[model samples]
Target: MERNIYMNTITVSEFSEDQNLIFNRVKKTGIPVIIMDKGTRLAEIHPPSLPEKQSRKFGCMKDRLKIVGDIISPASDEKDWEVLKY
Candidate 1:
């Protein structure tokens, strides 16, 4: 089932006059507010949603990744690595 949420709509003048009140209301209640200017929507103000906590799963990408070459050995000869000595 899909649920629809309604947002409170207000004019620019009202928001401009009572910025703190409107902002506090939005923060207290999770509902968002639509700011309209001359009957057209100009902006929206809402509180940020909390991020969901996620657990790390080991080996989740097993077999999905490819190893092109030998990982245990260096790609080039030992003499070529002397460039970093400085």
Candidate 2:
């Protein structure tokens, strides 16, 4: 299981006192800031995830790959097999 990660935990009162600094840090680091209240988790402040790259989709490299004829055929004859030689 993945563990919860944060720059650090802060109480609600402390967070309220330094919210701007905390927010700026979270945005710059791209990590979460866990806010707690009375020893329990209340909320989290985090930066938004980056947009997905379009180049990762299937067939994105189709134009870059070149296949010659008879791709399904074997490159060598069956008589050349090591097991057959024995």
Candidate 3:
């Protein structure tokens, strides 16, 4: 059985002889290059994927947190530590 993939096809000899050219083409075009040997598929050279942009939202968890008890004064029967006396 034979397959005809008519994209960017290059033989092993061509790839070995002109690796830099093929690499540059793949990098610039972001298209994969198919490597073939004796008319059989061998390997593919694909361009590196671009990193995704991350979106950050400030106060996204606002009002999600609950205040259980007093924040300013210490808990009942809890004496102030000496380290806190500044």
Candidate 4:
């Protein structure tokens, strides 16, 4: 009665017949169409993906981040911390 084919699939013949419409949908929706044949996945059709963002460089926030107090000194008195009662 029922088949096990994917819900988001398009047969090779259908893809061939309506390639223009399918490609237009792929371009507009950005969702890939899985080409199938007898429940076997054949190929995918969709627009090329774009990079999310450029890789960040080291020290790119060198001057952006603010620094305070002495660099080598402790932040607070050692006696103030109960965990350091060694």
**lDDT for each residue of candidate 2 in 1-86, tens digit (9 for 90 to 100):** 01223347888887877777888878988778898899999998879888987666887787898887888977799898888888
Residue-level lDDT tens digits of model 4 in 1-85:
0131223587887877777877877787877889888889999887778879976798778879777769787678989778899
Question: Candidate 1: where is the Cα deviation over 4 Å?
Answer: 1-7, 52-86
TM-score of 3: 0.52
Full-model lDDT, candidate 3: 0.77
Question: How would you encode candidate 1's per-residue C-alpha lDDT over 1-86 as one tens digit per residue?
Answer: 00112338887778777788888878889789898899999999989889998865998788799988799998888778887666
lDDT of 3 at 29: 85
Those runs of model 4 whose alpha carbons end farther than 4 Å from true positions after fitting are 1-7, 51-86
Clashing pairs in 4: none
- TM-scores for all predictions: 0.51, 0.51, 0.52, 0.49
Best by TM-score: 3
Clashing residue pairs in candidate 1 (N, C-alpha, C atoms within 3 angstroms):
none
State which candidate, 1 or 2, has the greater TM-score. Answer: 1
lDDT of 3 by residue, 1-86 (tens): 11222258878877887788788878888889899999899999999988998765997778899988789886644455666666
lDDT of 2 at 32: 85
Error of 1 at 23 (Å): 0.7
Best of the two (3, 4) by TM-score: 3
